[model samples]
Target: MVERIDAPAVGAPDPELKNSPIFDESDWDELSLDLELESGVCYFNDRSYAIGEFVCSGDELLRCEERGVWIREGACHD
Candidate 1:
């Protein structure tokens, strides 16, 4: 079964999604943003990702599994 990713313990609700009626927008935006990770990794209630996964931070793509520390995958292109 699918699990909910919007639980309060995961962190604050993404404002962009919270503002939308259907909540279809992404957590990303035009400016810089941050994510909370536990012990150098993100722990979602249902699953997780490792070093190779692509993390979208604002307009850039960071490649790192560790929280607070990011390895640059470079800026996202249009």
Candidate 2:
């Protein structure tokens, strides 16, 4: 199942890959990194991110750290 969430804009969709273009589970194996997340902020690397984690989205970087989802300026959006 894919989680419903927007891709943070901090990383700018990797610039290499288009956000609209999606891949299947099988293609995930081809990627050296674990960009296998269905939703929520993620990267093209072999690592996983947890909810309530820092993510940049909506053309801006959002921090989901201890303060929870928020704008870079520390605004609580979550």
Candidate 3:
């Protein structure tokens, strides 16, 4: 049987990942605006902007699993 793993606890630090610079202030601002315009929701980086769309809900963000993309609340990581 396949076991299931829970997503990292909300607000928990990510393991198996190293820090890296992702986006500058300007990039974040622009991306935020674009997402808002397209989906009516804004995304912010609690850590770094390298990881985009950390928080999203409504029809704003879509999760892409192996099966396909589906709308859902919260963040999606690859």
Candidate 4:
């Protein structure tokens, strides 16, 4: 299941990934130190996130137990 939230801009679609490409090759395995409010934000390795936490670019989908908030990104795959 997926949820939608208002963001600063509409996200572009990526047919190859079957979801919007949040991260590119460079973003792979990078730590998600902070939330992204814009589309196309990437989260890499060992990055901890939380739910209910607003991102600077995108929306939060998964909640992090330690952070006490939701993990957020620019776009999501439904």
lDDT of 2: 0.38
Candidate 1 lDDT for residue 59: 51
> Measured by TM-score, how close is model 4 to the native structure?
0.19
Task: Please provide, for model 2 over 45-65, each residue's C-alpha lDDT reduced to its tens digit, 9 standing for 90 to 100.
Answer: 223344454454444434332
Query: Candidate 4 lDDT, tens digit per residue, 1-78?
Result: 456643322233334433222333344446375753333323222232333333333332322222233244534434
TM-score for all models, in order of appearance: 0.32, 0.23, 0.17, 0.19
Task: Evaluate model 3: give its lDDT.
Answer: 0.30
Cα RMSD for predicted model 2:
11.8
List CA RMSD, all candidates.
12.8, 11.8, 12.7, 11.9
Name the candidate that leads on TM-score. Answer: 1
Clash count, one per candidate: 0, 9, 1, 17
Better TM-score candidate (1, 4): 1
- State each model's CA lDDT, in order: 0.36, 0.38, 0.30, 0.34
After superposing candidate 3, which stretches have Cα over 4 Å from the reference?
A: 1-59, 74-78
lDDT of 3 at 17: 49
> Which runs of model 2 end up more than 4 angstroms from their true locations?
1-10, 15-47, 57-59, 63-78
